[model samples]
Target: MMMRSKKIKLLSLAILSIGLSQNALAEDHWKLFLKNAYIDRDFDNDAVKDTGSWSQAISLFYDSKFQDTPIDQLQIGLDANVQYAVRLSNDKHAADSVLPFDAQSQKQASDYAKFGGAVKLKYKENVLKVGEIWSDSPVANIDASRQLVGTYLGGTLSSTVNDHLSLELGVLSKYSARNDDQFRKLSYTQNGNKIQSDGMSYIDLKYRVNDQLKAAYSFAHLENIFNKHYVGLEHNYALNADTQLNSKVRYFNVQDTGSIAAIDSQNIGVIETVKYKNHTVAAGVQKIVGDAFPALDGYIPELYFVNWNVTGFFKKNEQTYHFIYGYNFKDYVPGLNALVKYSYGEKIKLADGIENNESELNLIGAYNFQHDYLKGMGLQYLFAKYDTKYGNDFDENRFFVTYTKKF
Candidate 1:
């Protein structure tokens, strides 16, 4: 306990010293962004009833950079986020616990309303950063598709080489989960047991061959737990002025390590889409072989594109087919758009010959105000239905309104 307290004190002092020391030499650099959201979620025919209330949330992001010696090569900065959320006054469960900017209001959630920040240092194209920040990568990422996103605490070194290749090396120690206010160790779960990970690291590489083609490979490892490797290719082809095709193929390999080895698995996916005028149609297929998807704790919304509304259906021996249709009505009604999707999965054969099958249908519509005063204001609605032979069938509805301003 004493050591922990000392470490905390040291960290606080370091933050203060860096902030104050650079304040004198750092030049003018600061930014502020504000976003507000009102969200309502209702679930039908589930173990949990409809949450009695809605949620209103406001979030702010502020960052500043201080340069040394009037040059851009060496610099320091601090960034922080503040999130506030409250249940709807009318919600019967208005006093129910809260969650992060993540999903499912009726479920277990947390309060992300507190303050957190990180300090960053940059030199040229290489950046050495240490702090807590939002993630959007395939692994150790924050899924902000919902209202509150989680954050990561660690340090990383990233560099762009020769304008075509990018590289990153990082170590992550903790993650603030979307449904919990407390930051926890980066760990994985097996059976029903939580295995505390010693530490986690990643090596990510991406290369761009040309404007229309690119490939990437990333590897993440947790001591004595497991390792995840990914390889991907993306291409875009323009058929003409009004038509185009986009395609992607990706693969993941998960393997066990050290003492508590669980499962080893491989997964592959392919997707293709055609865009014509204001309409887009897409088809995709995914297959999982070997073992079930080796999902890490706190990891939600499958890191892969196979993820759907309810689940990715990424069980052992699971195969899924996906289809989607979307339209942009910008020309018809300015910033209006709509999308519908369906995903079907089968062949999740169990050892007893029981095949668990599932399917999902989702619909979404949104309108963004483009006028001057309400330019950044938007309204969105989403509905999803999940049907499964694996049980747990239910439907969900979500309504959201949002406004954001940057200064």
Candidate 2:
């Protein structure tokens, strides 16, 4: 514990110095985010007690791009971030019970700090980054659903093949979860036991068919656990100057590998959206085949599916329908928007032969200050209600305040 704390302090100091330095030679950018989240959970089954939590988080990021480098067409970049989160509510017992913490221990997770940094080398249209990485892709993504963000330790390379084609590859070995202060080997849980993996590697390609169509494919292997393949397509059509239509389709296939137990599943999703000036509406459907969807150890967010809501709706044999409505109030109040989303799932089959159903509703509102005094400040609020037949029900509220500055 002491060693971890010391490392955090050292990293935090280093990042803070870089962010606050006014005379830095490189072109630097900085951003700070603040968030508060609260949850109220209930259970239909009495054995599982109801719990709740309220937490606060602060995050700071610094990025520096060196303008002058010895190598022509080669750019050097440095990126770093530090995050701190703590339980702010007086209900310590409840907070400890429900907070995002190590599965093995909860007492030591009341408050924690973490830091990560990465070095980037960009030459022409190719970029290479090594160290702590924050990524967002179809197969692998960092989770920002909580007060803090999850990150991976790895190296990634991306290249632009042409004007309409690109490729990306990465190998990751360790990660820190949203609430964790230290990194650990990648792993997943099975029968209440943690099964560690050697590492993970992935490659993806994207192609633009035309001005209105795009396609992507990705494949990932979690050393000795499972192999996954994903394909996606997107299209856009303009109905008129003030109206547009967008459509998307995505598919995923997972199969077990090596000595691990069978981890097989398939997912299919389709979505359509229509936008008319300031109003937007969307509808989607998704299905899960074979076994339940398997996730990495650190509660990673699976953002590739259309039915990703508060519950994720990833149960085996589950079929879900999703709806969304959004309105942009920019004309009335610049930088303001609101959205409502709902998801319902049925034919969910777990180990039990019986089928179950689940549903979720979400409401979100956000506003960014457009005035000169607070141009970079923003505020957001979210409310979610998740009800399930085979699991606990949750009612959650989250508030966030953010500010960004560049120098």
Candidate 3:
């Protein structure tokens, strides 16, 4: 695995360097940002303890565009970024009580630092990108704390075949908790043994129909590990100049690859025999609300789905629902925004009577400062409440302050 990972990295770097050298050289742009955040959590069940934690991050980024070069139809660019973090407060025992044994030691720990960088190459309608990049799909997203940077090590090729179609392909390593410089894949330990996926590859396609509709499909294979497929459709309709309607629907299916078994009796007994499956649907509406409001972030309708795990997650099956809404005050408050969201999910029991239902609600508000001397300054707060029918109920709050500048 190490040998293969090294080869992929070397090959990607070569391609990026070659492509960038062939394009015109342009001016360089740089930016820097700093953020601080605090979190407090309280659980209704005394079994779980309350906890408080704080974190801070600093990031620097550089971008360069090529304008004049020998390649007439080619465009080239490069990006590099670095980020660092540290924990300011500690709640060791509080986190240990509720977090899983593995995660408790790593993710919930009080302090840690990580950094990574990436480089890319582009030519007209086609581009090849390499290094640590952030990628998101309906099934998975690389989430960064609003203050930090998130990334993955991989190479991706994206191109537009014509005006109406686009395509993408990529190979990637397992995701990292922090954007570290380590090029090797990490292992998950169980009973003192290490486990790792072989590799992951994916292909994506997009098609546009006139001005109101678009569709997308993606298929991914986690070599000898698992397979995932997704299909989605989006439509937009104008309702005069002040109102509009937007809709989106997506479906995902996942299963274990041939080299991997859906059931492993040596690890778990009867529970291993079950396979997982799931389906999800979502929609939303937006109203301009006059020139005073100007912008509407829209809302997600109430919807639910059932999911079965042929590969990941602990439980074999589950059901879930999500509803959310957001609005931006472009004219009223300039740079202020508010949002609310709720999600509920539960484990599905077959012949056995096991009950596990979890629900959560979130509220957020943010304001940005627009002054020249203190531009890119932001203040934000978030509140969340979580309830589990057969487990615990918890509440959490977070506050953030950020400042950013670019040159």
Give the winner by lDDT: 2
Please provide TM-scores, in order, for all candidate models, with all chains considered together. 0.85, 0.91, 0.72
TM-score winner among the candidates? 2
Evaluation by TM-score, superior candidate among 2 and 3: 2
* Collision pairs in model 3: 276-308, 276-309, 277-308, 278-307
- For candidate 1, lDDT tens digit of each residue in 113-146? 5356777778878877788856555655665655
- Comparing 1 and 3 by lDDT, which wins? 1
Regions of candidate 1 where Cα sits further than 4 Å from its true position: 1-53, 69-72, 89-112, 351-353
Candidate 2 collision pairs:
none
lDDT of 2: 0.81
The TM-score obtained by model 2 is 0.91
Instruction: Report how far off residue 347 is in candidate 1 (Å).
Output: 0.9
Q: Which 10 consecutive positions of candidate 3 have the poorest summed lDDT?
A: 293-302
State the lDDT at 385 in candidate 3.
Answer: 85
Comparing candidate 2 with candidate 3, which one achieves the higher lDDT? 2
Off by over 4 Å in 3: 1-26, 67-76, 91-111, 179-195, 259-317, 350-352
Instruction: Write down the TM-score for model 3.
Output: 0.72
The global C-alpha lDDT for each of the candidates, from Candidate 1 onward, is 0.71, 0.81, 0.55
What is the descending lDDT order?
2, 1, 3
From the highest TM-score down, the ranking of the candidates is 2, 1, 3
